[model samples]
Target: MSLDEVRDEARAFLSDHFPKWRKENNARGDLDFEQQRSWQRYLYEHGWGVPTWPIAYGGRGLGMLESMVWNAEKVSAGAHTFFNLVGLGLAGPTIIARGSDDQKARYLPALARGDEVWCQLFSEPSAGSDLGNITTRAERIDGGWVVNGQKVWSSGAAESDRGMLVARYDTSLPKQQGLVYLLADMHAPGVDVRPLRQIDGGAHFSEVFFTDVQIADDDLVGGPGDGWSVAMTTLTNERMSLGGGFGTFAMSFDEVVDIARRTGRIDRYGLVDIYARRTILDVLNNRVQSKLFAGQIPEAEGSVIKLLMAELGTLTADVAIDALGAGGMLAAEAPSAQQRFLGSHAMHIGGGTDEIQRNAIAERVLGLPREPRPDKEVPFKDQLRS
Candidate 1:
């Protein structure tokens, strides 16, 4: 379908089905877990969920433009797309791009259908931005590998049935090379998950501990020693998804401008400047989306979007706090803006740290001199830090 036609259909769908949830619970137009699951079921049944994937993978096989249109309309109507986020955006894409045929058949349908929720087990207490430094170990045993380690900041772990995890399989090799990727059942005997309470009183972030967790051989993804590259694929999808489809969500640059206008900050606080920057940011966003529509994997461009969005989010929250003044105390009416001000730090920490993203942008995008790693040749076991 043409872009205009797709937009029209999406608008119609939003008008017909989107729920106008309360601001306190529906920031970014997001739904609660149960609400998100039901909404995803409808989208999945109608071939709207995971629309970018092919029909065989339980998607509508829509073009990128159409998918963007659909997302924008949904967000505008306060529709939530939360339930299948990790499954659909991170795990499903990685599996589609890197999983074997059997693996694809096993995971994609359930993920797209929202029958199962998934989380990522990539970060550890010691390896947040420097993921290659993780110490989670998975040793080969009689039938499979025995994993023992702790993973931190895992989103949706409490409810996830499975997770895409990376573990060190061969410490003899370099840390990056010795890794293995596996799909782990969250309910397995040795798996322990504990949610970390956030400043906002939300417990979505979890820390997962594996005590001799046994992963069957069939759960392995990609070839032996291919985990790092496979992980890069997932990370790429993650970085892209983190930024968004544009002009969507309950809070955005547009909302920032709206708030500024409403509070009369537009006259004094350079709201026009924010609007101008948002215009340019939109152009940059569109450029990335155009490349994506052509089937190009946005490598450095993903980091650019991530960094921009991080800055934009902070700017909006800061402006909100400033503009709201006494009104900031009214959490019910301005929940999104108020909460945004309180939790602005997460944007920089989640996905990847802001500093790390800047380094990526500097070296990767601008072609600057790569930072020297003295430990590049060190074996995982021989490395001073475990």
Candidate 2:
């Protein structure tokens, strides 16, 4: 079958099966681990999952166009793609690009099959936007290295079995030069995870502490002092994944049109706002969509899509509230409009804050001057922090 045919088939299968598959409890809290494993196994058996990965890496050896179509169909079907979201979305691509042969053999299959859950361990208490300024120290030890420090705002770390961590190793080297990326054991004796409840009331992210955590040589993803470059690989993948079709939920502006027509709000001032939204939507479907087909290499512009989606999310939730008036918040037992309101805030904050993304686009994509940072050259130990 052609790629379109394959996508239609997947959509039809999902349309018939998704509702029954998504039991109420399954949607209550990020699909349970058992359900995730089962769902991944189903995808694996069906020649899906890891579509763009090499055949040798346990992927379907499918081309990017086919993979993109599959992702669009999957989202349209409302199929839960949360299983190994971070693992496959960010970590897997990084490993494929920069990891050693052994690393690929050990991690890629597990990541593809959902056997291993991965979290990003890049942000720190004092190093959110300025991640290169992280104070998490990894001292060289006899056999390998010993890590000591903390990482915060890590998504899914509480349930993650492993993490892709970036840390500073040698004080003598330049700040960006002495950094390294490694696979950290989440269950190691020195690793501690504490959930951070957000304004939305979900404990989806966590702060992780590593004290005297010993990492063997094999655990290091790239060579010592190459963390920045290795991190760029992951960062680029993260942006690509963000801009990738699957990353954007299929909640299009057409739905807003439907809601406005239903509520007779199409003639109001709010309708102008909706029109602006439709304009943004058109740019996405026309400009960005065509750019992808033209084979333009991706960049932090992926974050532009993410930022647009976040804005749309907020607008959508607000429109729902204004349309339903007093009744919007009443559906407590079912999936209510309030849930969307609660959830939209995270879209801007998670996956690198909107501010950080703008900075990246300005510096990397537009060739704007780099942001001033006096601490860029300072050693982790020498830097003073509150």
**Residue 139 shift from truth in candidate 2, angstroms:** 1.7
Native-referenced Cα lDDT, model 1: 0.81
Best candidate, TM-score-wise? Answer: 1
Runs of candidate 1 exceeding 4 Å displacement: 17-30, 246-250, 253-267, 326-333
lDDT of 1 by residue, 178-208 (tens): 9999999999999999999988667879999
**Candidate 2, run of 10 with poorest lDDT:** 247-256
Clashing pairs in 2: none
The sequence of per-residue lDDT tens digits that candidate 2 reaches over residues 1-386 is: 57778688768767766665566326544556777777776676565767778888878766556666777787776665677778988898888888899989988888887788999999999877667776799898887889999999898999899999999887766567779898998999999999998865678889999989999889897789889898888877776666566544424456556666776655366556755765775466445545655787655557677778788778776776676656555765224446677788878877678998788789988899997887777765576776
> Candidate 1 at 102: error in angstroms?
1.8
The TM-score measured for candidate 2 stands at 0.85
Give the alpha-carbon lDDT of every model: 0.81, 0.76
Model 1 collision count: 0
Residue pairs of candidate 1 with colliding backbone atoms: none
TM-score of each: 0.90, 0.85
